[model samples]
Target: MKATLPRWADLALIPAINLLLAFFFAGLVVLFIGEDPIRAVRILITGSLGSSYGIGFTLYYATTFVFTGLAVAIAFHASLFNIGGEGQAALGGIGVTLVCLTLDHTHWLLTLPLAILGAGLFGAAWAFVPGYLQAKRGSHVVITTIMFNFIASALVVYLLVNVLKVPGSMAPESRNFAAGAHLPFVHEMLAAVGIKVSRTPMNLTSLLALLAAFLTWALIWRTRLGYELRAFGFSEPAAVYAGIDPVRITIVVMLISGAMSGMMALNVVMGYQHRLVLDYVGGAGFVGIAVALMGRSHPVGVVLAAILFGILYQGGAELAFEMPSISREMIVVIQALVILFTGALENLTRVPVERMFARLGGGG
Candidate 1:
């Protein structure tokens, strides 16, 4: 039977309830560790949102999650699990680095658009191989993409070691990008307009993240291709019966997903790092899978989920610092609980609420 739920309930209430449940269990863990859960919650809130300083870092982290979350969310809508965001994003950093080295002296305005194209093309090409194998050779996308991730890591390492590394530098990284390539910080932009804010890594890429979310929403809900994609996702046989080309849908979805994942480099490498570096993605791609699950594969939900995680990252740091007993591993466990409930155990809350609504004659 189809479980009928109101739009608001499915999109908002269920996730909220799941989040609370996660925190409730996390609180118990804190108590077990001999800390007051309430105080910990307060510290969590304050550390991420209490001051401009904290907020800056929080938003900086959120910006990357927004991109990776959207990447995973798009693939989810098409019933494709694109687990290679890590590799795609790494390749994107290579794209950005090459572009910055060659065109940074020209001006940021000129460099950004070309960099976007390069990142998108590289990422899409990487994804296209897996999609082709899935559509033509019957190779499973999950295995192929996962394999490609390891390959991408090796490729990047080799490039840094042999090709892009600065002369005589022991670090496995390139030299700093030129001044023109430096992205203006949020504080600097605000200060230009006479409003002061705390300095942070947060930069113009945050705006691009929002724009990408909007574009994703429009593409998924308002386009004919979206209909075909959803139909394909719902049932491959049905889609083929309806004259949708399965191969085309599969390849296109992966391409779009890979492009979004690749764009994450814009924030980390271009905006914050200012040069290529090893392991710069910092597992945001994996975090995106959790974000996509919690968000129900919707763009707006992805944004909110991204922010929630940003809080966990920024606030978790402060929690460990202010109350050293809590420890970093405890914070990670708390985060794991959130992911566990939101992704794996979502139906735990969903089924009960659905039954309640059914009994009340409030749903179809």
Candidate 2:
């Protein structure tokens, strides 16, 4: 059967409209609170993009989202809803910390590859358990993955408190990475090329995120494994008849997804925090689910959506700080509205758009 809407409309137009609707309603909320929505928007824009400093922070946040967003999108391609990104990312942080600590004397140029490998391995291993259960024991992936998030948290806490934490420290976090283990900041990299920019937490990891996005696109659309995964996602019975193994596909997809999620830790552990911190994932894992939904499960869409969210996050913080009247909680409510419109209420505009397109010869 032909799709009711064209690919362009499905991928771009619908999301654009949904975003506009989300902003419109969010404006209404601002009005109800006796604030000028237009002014609020201007502040958000200025905060997130107006200055080099703000832009740096925005890109940094977007980099983390890119990894998690791709993770969710990959799982979606295999008919899997792997919600263990929070846990996977957490474990990935552990992997990064372990590697960085182990190679404290090495140059960052040398440590990076090892850190990536460690993060991927730990995340993949963490995800393997849930995937194995789902494939071999009929355990639902959603339940297992979600449950693993808490388990991951507990495990990290235990490690930090007992094994990883520096002696005489009160915080439940590992010691800072050595000088050589520190990834260069984005501004430092730019300055090296003679371009002066404001400093922020953003770093070279953003480049890696973009490269990963490209790789994800290639994996999903150009590879045999991707074809098999998509075939299974589209129709399991047909894929099985075509000789695809559900167990293997399920496990492989989960591993890939988990690795992607785990790699997000690089942005925080290596680039920003330089240490293992509690709740470091900061719900980016959950946000990735919304990002994948908004992006229509495409790598490009995920990057774009992740940036949009990056704007909300960095901009929202500025909004609360400057406005004072809006408050941080209000900013969260605004962000929640975006998620609600983009994810839960996504179909609200779809039916009408489909009707219009159908009337205009959308039928194949």
Candidate 3:
């Protein structure tokens, strides 16, 4: 009989494996520090779900992760590793901040789309530079994109510290954005329904992030452009033989990735901070790579993965505060372990070493 498995089985296995690895790695860290692993684990779980504020914080972090995760996933689908998400997101934040500070209108109806669009355009432009270089000059995108991240950081610092620095302000940030640029808080709206949340950060940006994921899923799985991009990703030579233009697809994919990064500004600019500031993206761009990998570059998986990261981030901070021995950096260790295990999963399943272990067990 031919062996078969349900599609859902395969889908469910990834998360199961990831969670197992995460716990095992975290447990090891706890052991090394001479702390009770179970207690640490319990603290992490309760801190994240024990209160309304904790849940709100989790979702708030998820908003940034989901947006940047989509950026990474989009590039992965096209077989292009666009590592310039940091720079792209920074530029996007700058774009929106400029518009928010300069625009005289206080109506969100006019400012919201414009702010998002400006950020998207800035991010697309930032990414297009590398795409053009890769397509025309045969430059390696990985190296160029990494360099661009440094350049973007320097550019933003200069703009914030020198050019856009608000007069008489002793900070390295911009002035508060116009009221119209702020995202609506869900908690405030919930008051009308008699559902009160104490000390929450939840906002409408989470809803936008979900909508972005759905749109990205439809684009990748149900559209012609997505088909061509995936075809190119699988095999560039084959794509060319099939009359697909690899160069154009490469540029287009980078633009889409950059645009997604640009949307990340919504989490900070519109969702939390009413103004753009230095380090607004807060390393979310780099974390997005882990999210994309954990999700296997699928849209739905990306959302789930983003949520997991968000939980770890918020929970780990709480753990650090409550336990004198534990450090918030443990979250980074956990993330690194997840990436290593997931990266090796495919190869581990095919290795002959595994077969020997299986044979030894079966002989018993």
Indicate the worst ten consecutive residues by lDDT in candidate 2. Answer: 1-10
How many steric overlaps does candidate 1 have?
A: 0
lDDT score of residue 85 within candidate 3: 89
Better of 1 and 2 by lDDT: 2
TM-score for each predicted model, relative to the true structure: 0.97, 0.98, 0.92
Off by over 4 Å in 1: 1-3
Q: Write the per-residue lDDT of candidate 2 for residues 215-276, one digit (tens) a residue.
A: 99999999999999999999999999999999999999999999999999999999889999
Ranking by lDDT: 2, 1, 3
Best by lDDT: 2
Clashes of each: 0, 0, 0
lDDT of each: 0.90, 0.92, 0.82
TM-score: model 1 vs. ground truth: 0.97
| Candidate 2 residue pairs that clash | none
lDDT of 3 at 192: 71
